[model samples]
Target: MSTALTFTTSRRPDGAVVLTATGEVDMSNAGAFATALAGARQTAADTPFVVDLTAVEYLDSAGLSVLFPHVEHLHLIANPLLAPVLTIAGLDDVTTISE
Candidate 1:
């Protein structure tokens, strides 16, 4: 079953698109996460896509997989707990990560 994962998309004053995620993100809800990212990419393909995971309680490999294809166009604002996972997955090499 899917957990309670919510995504909110907004644009920054600087024109960057940000998608904020809350709650747990696992295999069950990873597709939803991908859909949100796809929508944000469609809205502004040329601009940077920032994902804010500060409010997310948990994230699994499935959640990370959804981000792989967009790494080149993505930036991440994650909490300390998730930062290391991102780094270990080598996402930090392709995308900018902020704690």
Candidate 2:
């Protein structure tokens, strides 16, 4: 069974695409996360992709895996709870992470 997850996509005033995720992200729902990211990419191609995970309660490796390909073009906004995990995964090396 998939965990409950919510994804909302919008364009920023500066034309950046923002994908905001709330709830748990794990193996069961990683595919949904990927789909949401893909939609954001399609909507804002060539623009910055910002992922707001401030409302996320949990994120596992499966969730992180889907973000790898877009790391260079991604900007992440997360709460203190997930900041260390992102850093540990080396996502911080490729993307801009704000806590």
lDDT of 1: 0.91
Error of 1 at 8 (Å): 0.6
TM-score, per-candidate, Cα-based: 0.96, 0.96
- Please give, for residues 1-99, the per-residue lDDT of candidate 2 as tens digits: 889999998888888999999999999999999999888877878777899999998999999999998887789999999999999999989899999
Supply candidate 1's per-residue lDDT for 35: 96
Strongest candidate by lDDT: 2
